[model samples]
Target: MQQPGYFAEDVLPLLASLPTWPQPSRKGATRDAEWILWVKMRMWNRLKAQFTGIIESDFKEQGLEEEDLAWIAGGLVDAGSATSTANFHNIVLYLAACPDVQATAAKEIAAVVGDDRAPAMSDVSPLPYVWACIEVLHRNTMPPWAIRHFTDADVTHKGFVSPKCPAVVCDTVALQFDEERYPDSFAFRPERYLGHTEFAGDYAAMADAQPRDHWTFGAGWRVCPGTRPAKSNLALMLANILWAFEIRPPTGAEKGGKGSAIDLSDDAFDMYPLRQARPFKAGFCLRLMLQEGLTVEAAF
Candidate 1:
């Protein structure tokens, strides 16, 4: 789970660059999915270009004007500098380096996805545990606020007037942690999204009707067009990393700090530029088949 800021700082920029990409002619809502896919592909391509640019920039610092074109021309290398690539890289790096959510994710992956094959986009859909992990990550490290926008027409909230063109801002973190909506709101219980429970019904409805509450992505008509693709990419990255490594707290250390317990409160925002996370440690290792060739590994 790459945290909410990663989407805003990295993924969104790459997605923003993609609208200019050439689109095939199509009519009506018939081609909606195709158009979405086209935009996604364009976003990914632009992200790759941006990542390449970052690599070039880093080389410039070392007195190298350009990356080795031969090496670069090789398709789909894991060079980690561009927007989406960097976002994924940061996530993988954090999972490898951070102790909190990383270990839990690895355990879930090992129990569900296994290591023989890396996770694919399709696999993410059936993996409720993985989805819950993503949700927790978002709740814990989301940006303090969403971008402010003005409504084109007047709106009312609780009988109060929100006059037309009034500036409106949404508090993302507050909404996710609201206890009335999310019971035991501060706890990192992935089960909240699993099984056929009351909240699960709400989750299904939200998945079907309104996805805005999944506010790691924004809202309304201008919401992230890259939401589906970004999620696919995120799921694949998380799954592969979990399948490949084991995460755990460092020896002689507690889950979060020296004699301090893991805090799921809003206070856990220190590691980000906008919010710093308390220092934590974890270890990683390759998982081996434990029984009769049946094993579970994490996927995104």
Candidate 2:
């Protein structure tokens, strides 16, 4: 599905029109460019504020404390260092956009964990269903590439050989969507991991058969140190979203008939030629149960 808008539509055209050479002579042009960049920055900040407000509002309505809300937001913010904050923010924004996952997670948490107290990290862990949902989101929506590595010495993998300085890349999308690893690879079936019989005897062997294959957080020494903390934050946010709402396709949208069907062909971009695009849409409504018995709504 091609997103109707093109990359050059909004700001790119203006950026492309600017002078690129003889910089010292283009003082006025430089000032204009700087001003435009500042405006773009402000626009981004406003978007962030709006989403942050939504999350905060949800927390408040659940009778959570201001401090707890701040902690949750801060944990997400601090998961990546300053340089990676924007990437982390983008990930959170994508998660927020997925209404079905959010509603399911919130419902599960509310039923299993309850509203008498806020969820602790430990409380969030045993909910394998929630974690599996998070895994799917991460696998499906993660950036298409990680930083490329140049092998410093001869490297052998299986029978293949590569010399030093060969460019090595990680094709995350392919790894995540491999059909052999994930039978019915595109379906969103949380129960796939629910019971012992479903996975057979060896847990490790069963895990190997799924595209929960590689580390979405990269691998070895350079694996994202932030992976654990990031997952924790995601688990919490997802739990909250699930506990608070119900997700469904927008009215009049087509639904797969009776049996399981998944549309995995959603258009996406690769590392190079990156462009802005419209994402698939699903809508959500807050569950009334959350609102019925709540206290200290103002603090959150």
Model 1, residue 50: displacement in angstroms?
Answer: 14
Error of 2 at 181 (Å): 1.6
Give the worst 10-residue stretch by lDDT in candidate 1.
Answer: 74-83
Per-residue lDDT over 113-142 for candidate 1, one digit per residue giving the tens place of the 0 to 100 score = 676677777677666666665545444433
Cα lDDT, all candidates: 0.51, 0.51
- Native-vs-model 1 lDDT? 0.51
Per-model TM-score on C-alpha atoms: 0.51, 0.52
Candidate 2: tens digits of C-alpha lDDT, residues 184-278 = 87666544544422211122233353423344566444455556566566667666655655543333325442211222344432332221123
lDDT of 2: 0.51
